[model samples]
Target: MNQESNNDQASAMNTEQVSDQSLSRRLKLALGLSLFAVMAVILLWLSSIKNIQNLEHDLAIKLDTFNEKNMQSLALAKNADTRSAEIAARAEILEEKYTESFDQQAALKALYQELANNREERMLSDVEQLLVIANQQLQLAGNIKPALLALQAADTRLQGFDSQKAVQLRKSINQDIQRLQNLPLADLTSISLKLGNLSQRVDQLALVSDRHPNSAQNKIAPDTSNNPWRKLTQEIWQDIKGMIRIERIDRPELPLLTQEQTFFLRENIKLHLLTARIALLRHDEVTYKSDLAAAQSAISLHFDGRESLTQNTLLEIKALTSNHISTELPDIEQSLRLLNLYKLSFVPALAREPKSKRLP
Candidate 1:
């Protein structure tokens, strides 16, 4: 019985120990699982905190970027607004210029049309009038230069027309011009001015005298001695000589002029010079020659002929009188006649045309 109890106790103790070891192992496993859960929870909380911080930082950066982009967009928008206003102003200026240009173009067109309307007839009339004026100048004024100019103007007008019909007229006008060009023209103005100068010098001419006498000086009476009787004798002889004396003059005698006659002579000379100037200006060949001759004769007779100035003036006057004042100039009658015929033919044909076919 004792042995059986001991064995039974041993078995019981082994079973109890096995059961405690199993329970301890289960407690150890549960503690290890709790430690792992606590560590996982701490790790997951740290990761979550870090993720929150990253999200906040990212949000701040995005906000800053958005603000910067928004500010730049605002500035660009403002610049766009300013540029748009400037463009509007420029467009308005351009529009005004366009309007002014259009108006000027319209005025130019009207002016061109008006000019075209009367261009042909007016040109022909101008040419005809020029030819007439040239003829008149040649005939009336004897102005070769102006007549040539008028003829040249007519020729240029004909050439501007570039018509075959104007060829004969141009040829006639050219011939007239050449003829006028070949003629020598006297400088009447210079001659007239010279005459006027001579007239002014008439007052300075010295009067001529037929004879000049040598001046006699009285000799001092021979020293009259203090002798009263001798002085009385000399005085008595002088009184006898003074009462009746006959002196012989060596020079030819000339009649003395009264002051009034001298004045009248000078006035007559001036009058002649003035009359000669007038005749010269009038281009009166007959009166010019006669008056100049009379003036020369008067100057030679009254003025001192030996004076160098007088001799030179007389020579110049003689030279001027030798020139022919009147000259025959070739006329532009041929050109005038040709222009009239052209006008008669051209104007009649233009008049016969229908109104619709006319320029205007």
Candidate 2:
């Protein structure tokens, strides 16, 4: 019995030992598996940490590059702003210069226009003055030659202009000049010279009472025999012949005048001639003829008609009386009217002309 009990106990113990060994093996295997899983997790954590460090370094470099690019952009933007400001200032200056240039051009154009107008006005004034002189010469002075010259000069002055009114005015002036040229010139200078020569010959004129009978028979022939009785007898006969002169008077009784009376008569004749000369110069035909006739009648009645000098004076007086001193003169009214018309219409014609057609 005892043996059986000990053997049974030993067998149980062996079984318990086997069971303990199996449990320990199972625990050790589970612990080994848990340790291997923990190691793998640690290795994965280490690898993830290294990758995170590399990513941090890359991000820093990228941040620095971005900062540099931002600075360059700011600098470029600043430079662009500066350039825009300068361009704006230059544009303002260019605009001011353009405005000044335009103003200067406008001023120059105005000055040129004013100068042209003044030139035209001056030319018209000169023509008007010439016309006035011509009118005065014709109307007041009665001088055809001077008036004709003045009209010709005015026409020549207007010849430079091409305007229609100027042409018409020139035509009128030329007509006036032609009319004056056709008129007969008076020979006043020749007539006046003849009258002066006649007045100088007045002192030498012989009077009717100045004539004397023949005294040749009263002179005794002075021979070498000196006869006193014959000389006495000849002187007595000469006195008798002188006292009773047989002369046939052709006209009425001659007026016996003293030296003073003869001088006064000659002065009266000269006064008549002087009056005739004044009348001729004054263009008074009636007065000139009447005074000349009076002078001629006085010379014939007071002076000896048979004397050659007296006959010559009478013939000259007759020639002077036949001359016509005064005549109708042509008026310059047509030319003056045309000039006034041109002056009045000048402004309108200038206005109607185109800018391109206006005289420079």
Candidate 3:
């Protein structure tokens, strides 16, 4: 019986030891599970921390990008505003230039209209003035060439007006010009000049003397002896000879004149020549002819005709006296009358119009 109890105690000890080993194993498993859970929680917490850090970094980058984009947009907006301002300034300048150009065009149009409105009256006034000048040239100066030129200018000016009223006036002017051209014109100026020259040469005429054939001859007394006693003896001899002189002179007998009479004769001749010149200028044919004849007679009677100058003067006087003077000159008044009539007719029409429509 004691041997059996000891064997049973050994079996009980083995069962308790097995049960403590199981309990230790269970504690070890619980510890291992607790470590695993702690490890998992730490890992999750680390992952969350890393994720938060990444999110924070991404948010910072987005903020930086947003700030940069905002800066770029602001720069773009500023540039756009500057460009808009420049465009507005340029538009203002263009508008000012357009307005100035429009004003200039308006002024030019007004000036053109004013010139067009007064063109006819101004042309008419020019025609009238030219006609007046032409009339004066014809009547006063007797200048056919200048008068014709003025008339042609007037006609040309009338042509610019293209008026039918000017036809009769132009025709009258042309007729007057033709008549003037057909009229005989005396060269009175040339004749008067020749007469004046002849008058000047009257003083140079050589006086004629009957005592000498070609020149003046003065009778000289015979020479006496040079010695005083011989001169006395010669005088006594001449007294004894009865102071007789036997000279055979073949000179023609001429009326003797004193110095006063000779001076009067030359002055009378010059006076006649001057009178002839006056008559020539007066266009008096009868008076000029008579005066020149009287001068010729006086020169032939008192002066030597053999001189070349005297002969030339006589020939020129004869040539001048031969030209006949015509009392009739063509009437240049026809054109003037026509111009006056045209003015009279046109003046009433011009006067009936308003003062602003009249010629300036």
Candidate 4:
């Protein structure tokens, strides 16, 4: 009876464990299916959002690029106009100040001249003073037209002086000239022409401003502009540097010429160049050669046509090689001969002249 009860309990325990395992497997399958569905939905949503983001970013980039291009144009126009206004104002101020100064100086000079010459009593109603004032005003008036002309020229330079976008800038300049014609300034045609030039120049700068890569992000223009005198000075400097490199005048171990000799050569070259410059100015070759020969002698280089010095003296230098000097004191002995020769030559010449009467 005890053995049969133990077997029955063991079978019952095994049946319960099998049933629990079956339930647990079904629950795991259901949870896994739900998780797969949620993950699939999340992946699809992320894909759609990513495409939208890329497109939005692309649109923003393109818009910014377009705005950058437009901004370059705007900045060029605005800057050119602003600079032109500044130049005009400056020129006007300078002309006015210079004219006033000229007027005052002329007045004072006239007063001074009048007082110095004692013309105050000779002139009627101070006509001389009035005349001087008139002359000064006339001179100032003459210069006024030139000053405006210079401004107009600057304007022209501003208009057509495009470094870039020649076509568009020129068209824009034409429009600007048309607009300028409506202003109240005299010499409208000339002023308009100048404005046209300025607009063209702006267009040029804008065109050049576009060439640099990523100019939209970095809008700085190239420094291609040149100044007349400054450019000339640069060219001159470059030329000097090139010449220095070429000549190699300071080279060590230079054969056949010491430092002093080289210095003399350079000095002579400069002197010749100076002489040539003077000759060119005067157009006289004889004068040039004469100056050059003199300069050569100054450098210890002998020149042609040196006069032969003659010694007709009581004493003469006597060398044993050419004269009758047998002693070692030949120099002293020759000097004594020269002294005697000088006395003999002078005495006859002095005797021929009329003698002064003895003082009473």
Candidate 5:
């Protein structure tokens, strides 16, 4: 409605411009009005263009400022990334190098502690307990070279042990060790030698048990012999030594009983008979007595130690020989008692035995 009203007013104004008496006067007035309208249009269009240009200039300045600030932010981020990478690389290098040196020094400190006398002495009280632990561990799967090296290392470290144990260990254990390399079951070889000796010892000692008898009421007469217990103890000692040598090659099949052991066991009993005759001829019950006692202890040690030796057959012998000897046989009781100590060692042995599951 407003646009129509405006159009009507413009038409009326155009009519008035043309209204005149002379054609020349009217033409001049119409031309003046058209020129004025054109001028007004040109001025309005010019003002609009100027406003647009000013707006574009202000926007351009804002864009330039934004681009500059963005560039600075990007450069700072890159610098931070580079510094972080450098710090991380340095930290890794220090961890690899210095940490290794620190650990090496700590290891040296532990070694020094191992050699200290106070520390060494402290370990001895538990040494007997550790013997089985060591034996069990030694029994487990291990490389031969490493096992031998570890054993040698132990010997080297304990080289300065107390004189008493050192003497016995040297005189007995080391002697047995001399034959170790030749044996397949490295742990049992020393005990094998002891067993060999013990077979004869047992047979000979049996004679004493036969003569004196543990059931004897009193010393009725000399009987031209040592006490029965002494003889029995001696015999048991010798038998155990031989038994330790009794190992099976097939290992896991039944209880072990090697060829060497069978041969030693059979022949040794005969040798004991001869030894008894010799004792009778020499009138040297003391020699027999001493040897029998010593043999008992030595054999006991093997059974109780690394050989994982056992006394099953010996217990059978005791049952078999129970009626053969009387109750007065102190020597037999003593030997049996010592053997009993080692007998307990069988528990672990049988548990670990390739075949047997009886106690030690």
Candidate 6:
């Protein structure tokens, strides 16, 4: 029994020993697992701290670059603001300058319009004055040439205009000129010149009463070379023939006049011609014809009909009597009336026209 109990007791002790070893091994495994877990946790925490420090350093570098860029951006923004202010000021100045230029242009336009109107008015006034002069020449003085010249000058003045009134005025003036040209007028200067020539030739004219034969040719001189008795006989015969003077007489009576009376007769004839010339210049037809007829009658009665000079003088006087000194003048009232009408109507029409329209 003691041996059996020892065996049982040894078996029980072995079982206890086995259970204690397994428990120790289990404790060691658990401690090793805890230590490994603690090391892994420390490694993970260290790695995470390193990663955090790297991230913080990189973030600080990025922040410095961002601050520098922000400063540059601020400077650029300031410059841009200054430029914007300058541009705004310049824009305001430009707007003011444009407005001033517009005002100046408007003023210039007004001055131009005023000058144009003044020029036109002055021209029209001058035309009116010229037309008045023409009318005076036609009505007061019977001078057709001066009136024609004045009318032509007025037409030349109107040539610058293109209006219908100007054309009508020109047409009227032309009609007046044509009528004046158609008139037959005497040349007073030529007739006066011819009469003056005839008056100067009064001394050369031969009178009928002054007719005489040459007596010196018939008188014989005593010839000294001939015999004295023959010369005495010739002288006696010449004296006898001289006492009985016989002349051929065609007229019944001859007028006996002294030298002073003959001079007075020529002076009277000159007075008649002078009166005729004066009457011609005065444009008196009745006085001119009567004086001319009286001068012709005096020349025919006093002057020798056989003298060429007397016949020519009478012919000239007869031709002068037929000359017309004056003619009927056409009235220039139509042109004057048209010019006045144009002056009255043109002003209102000009006023109605637009300011934008300009003269050529």
My TM-score estimates for the predictions, one after another, are 0.49, 0.54, 0.49, 0.21, 0.23, 0.52
lDDT of 3 by residue, 36-88 (tens): 99999999999999999999999999999999999999999999999999989
**In candidate 2, what are the lDDT values of residues 173-240, reduced to their tens digit?**
88888788777777777888888888888878988888765466566665455888887777788778
Model 1 clash pairs are none
lDDT of 1 by residue, 155-267 (tens): 78877665555788888888888888877766777777877787778777766753332223222375557898888877777666556645448855445667687778767
Which ranking of candidates, highest lDDT first? 2, 6, 1, 3, 5, 4
Residue 269 lDDT in model 1? 65
Q: Pick by lDDT: which candidate is best? A: 2
lDDT of 6 by residue, 50-149 (tens): 9889888888888888898899899899998999999999999999999998999999999998886676667678777877887877677666667778
* lDDT of model 2, residue 247: 64
Which structure among the candidates has the greatest TM-score? 2
lDDT of 5 by residue, 265-345 (tens): 445454543453344233344543443344344333322222212254344223322221111111112222332343343
Cα lDDT of all candidates, in order? 0.77, 0.83, 0.72, 0.44, 0.46, 0.79
Off by over 4 Å in 6: 1-122, 199-283, 304-309, 345-360
lDDT of 4 by residue, 1-360 (tens): 777787778777887788778778777877787788778878878887898888889988988998997899899889989999999999999999999999989999998976844432232123223323333322333222233333233234334323333233334434433433443333323432432332232212121111223324333333366767766666676556545423335634323545575556545545553653344233344644454444333332221112121111101111101221111110112222332342343345657556663323
TM-score, prediction 1: 0.49
Q: List the residue pairs that clash in candidate 3.
A: none
Winner on lDDT (4 vs 6): 6
lDDT of 6 at 113: 86
Cand. 4 Cα-lDDT: 0.44
C-alpha RMSD of candidate 6? 12.2
